[model samples]
Target: MTTTLHVAIDSKTKKAVVFPLVFSGVILLLMMIFGVVMLLGQGKLIELNPNMFYKIMTIHGTGMIGVSALAGSCIIWYFLKQYVPLNTAVFRLNVYLFLVGVAMVLVGIFAYDFAGAWTFLYPLPAQSGGMWGKTGAALYLGGMLVIGTGFLILLLEAARAIIKQYGSLATSLGWPQILGKEKGFGPPPTVVASTMVCIVDIIALITGAALLSMSLINVFVPSFTIDPLLAKNLTYAFGHVFANSIIYMGVIVVYELLPRYTGRPWKSNKIFLIAWNMSTLFTLIVYPHHLLMDFVMPKWMIVMGQVLSYMNGLPVLVVTAFGALMIVYRSGIKWDVASSFLYLSMFGWVIGVVPAIIDATIVINHVMHNTKWVPGHFHIYMGLGACAMILGFMYYLTRLEGGRIDNKLDYLTLWLYILAFLGLTGSFLFSGKSSAPRRWAEHLPEWIPADMVAAFFGTFVTITFLLFLVRFISYSSNIGSKINQSDDIRPSTHG
Candidate 1:
């Protein structure tokens, strides 16, 4: 727990993280509102036209994933800087690019009525019927490309710095430890995790950018076309990898903070190194599971997808969850908002993986993959798992820098957030079990009950997040105040 950092984070670098967190919190609440609105429309409680509903859906999916990733990057930057000599300018650039991309996406959706879902699956952008045109598709796809470029650059920098400091990426991932050459503790868990994320996300983002660029060009030049099957492959490969990577980045918070609160060391041993390496491989290859419904996707890929999907996140999840329990078992660790949320995040990951695995089965994928089941598993996974890490880090920061103490309302909101999220995800899973179709703007009378139930709970989830956001914003000023009034990134620093 007393692991001292070689590089000290100046006040300015701290703000780079603090600002992104607050922004992410604000976006979380906003996106949740859009979620509830979609549910209300499906439940027939609100008069949402199909166009408006789809627009909201596109933004909701895109915004939640984007904001969560932004928040996750904050966790990575905050702790990772302690180990590596990072150029804060690159980090700051990511946030800037995210904001600009978000603005363009907003205009594309609301102004131009871009109704293509976040999947942006190839030909769909070029063929939006009369709902949207080339301009809207360009804006949305271009926005995504811009965001992906920034993240890719940030990751490239991380990969470079890791190589510079540790001699190689393999060394940083503790290959020596995993191969039984070095028998002691490996690099810090943060380094190992960051290295894995860098490798996977860099590949994921580049693949996505290629697809996005082709999609954008196809929009302007209708004669240019891509094979739909190939497009779907690119879609899930990029979407699944990029989206899942948020949790990988978010988990850095868990690894860093758990041991700190428990007053124990979270060592990276051979088992831990092996688990991470396994996770990286599986995470990259498991996207094929998402395409099991496509019969044309070759037999071997289908078999491999189903097999790896079951193993995808299990390795690191098991180690982290078990390590957490062992470290805190009877350590008399003090309970607070941060600690509570950290533990809750683990519960989220564990519970979320079960249904995800269930859906990954070849048979179940045929039945449930296109239904609300997919959303049910991922919501809990992202909501309680990844988002909790960001929220925990928020509380963790408040306590560390602002000396913020919990009020009764904090506990009340925590209970409301967890229970409400459970209620919402439960309704989603139930809807899937009943064969309710997902991504539909309107629901049949039979599905309305579940839709309404989800809407009811979704409202609370959004409201509780609003409270959480407000709380974090209240202390944004004191979050490690080494303020350099100039937050600008100088071009010279780019080199």
Candidate 2:
């Protein structure tokens, strides 16, 4: 195999990279804005109808999830080009497909009331009103299918490149080949983990696409027995895995980028690798946990779900925490805005893991299965933890793109965001424990006046998010015009 020199970022690739980054940022901002508005209004603190609340929920979830997937793909694309021999033509095609797919999904969401949750479980879609609703569901599913297709193509291309470069999956999996001992140029851990993730995504895409297609067929074509159980299983199967994979990808960013700003080694310790592998394996099988509330599911399956859910915490606590700890107490610790944000992400993960662990229990699951606690736990885990990772990664990319970081401002804003987010969501969780239900627009019980707490917290969160929006916009606009070396406080030369 022939070796090549490192690729430099040029004007063309830079433009390509900036487009998706900007788009993703805009989408995320819009989601946050709409979310705040919806929460404030629907909680009866500001007064809004059920229809408006549902609409906002649909927009927020669709925008947030779609943007997240796009951001992940963009990150994969941007870094893959630096080392991997990606096919430019295929890459370009994938970008367009993703864009088109996202557009269709958005249009579908806006066309009708899709309060079926982002999961869009079957029978609910069937139970909804009129033809437009059905059509919207079709369009949404179609759009997701198209996006999955694009992801598959990208994965295939990456796999082909890996095979061409390193011979076979076996060779790539081997120690020498992966360690880059043969050529004196080791691939980053992100690249290796990315390859594995792509493979998993491909399988997920196929399974999800097939199930979605079956559902659509059952909708249009008569004489098709739409197995509700099968469809539900497939939907959750895809939803659970897909959602978890975002965190998996975020972990790569955490491991690869965080250490850069912290002046620490990117340690791919054996335990870390094992944890990662086990997490991935466990993710594929953990979908049953969502079905624990259902009676039709087997007793053993329900038990397995709880067991896996608890087991999932091991990798996160041991591997993720230990790795961060390695850098925390090291000599010459330098904390910049990006590093501060990264550290905060770990903190969010730590706080979230407790609620997540509690929710995994059969007893607690019985009480808080579909309550506000669910969103509360996930907001910390995925929103603060995964989303914070995305924010930090974007900050790193901004720096890489030659943006000057305002260390003081960034650090202050990071703390504000985290504190407000926790305060708001923590109140929501408290309400859930007090038997408050989720997705209610109005007529909340007089005894449960948690909306007051939520409203107060929401105000703080809104301001913090708005602050982030301003910082992001200003930084992006002035990215190429300044150089502040003070932000680069860490030792530049890695040992």
List lDDT for all candidates, in order. Answer: 0.88, 0.68
Taking the tens digit of each residue's C-alpha lDDT, what string does model 2 give over 215-264? Answer: 66755764565777878888877877777666666666666655655556
The number of clashing residue pairs in model 2 is: 0
Residue pairs with colliding backbones in model 2 are none
What TM-score does model 1 achieve against the real structure?
A: 0.96
For residue 298, give model 1's deviation from the true position in Å: 0.8
Give the Å error, residue 151, model 1.
Answer: 0.8
Pairs that clash in candidate 1: 11-482
What is every candidate's alpha-carbon RMSD to the true fold? 5.9, 4.2
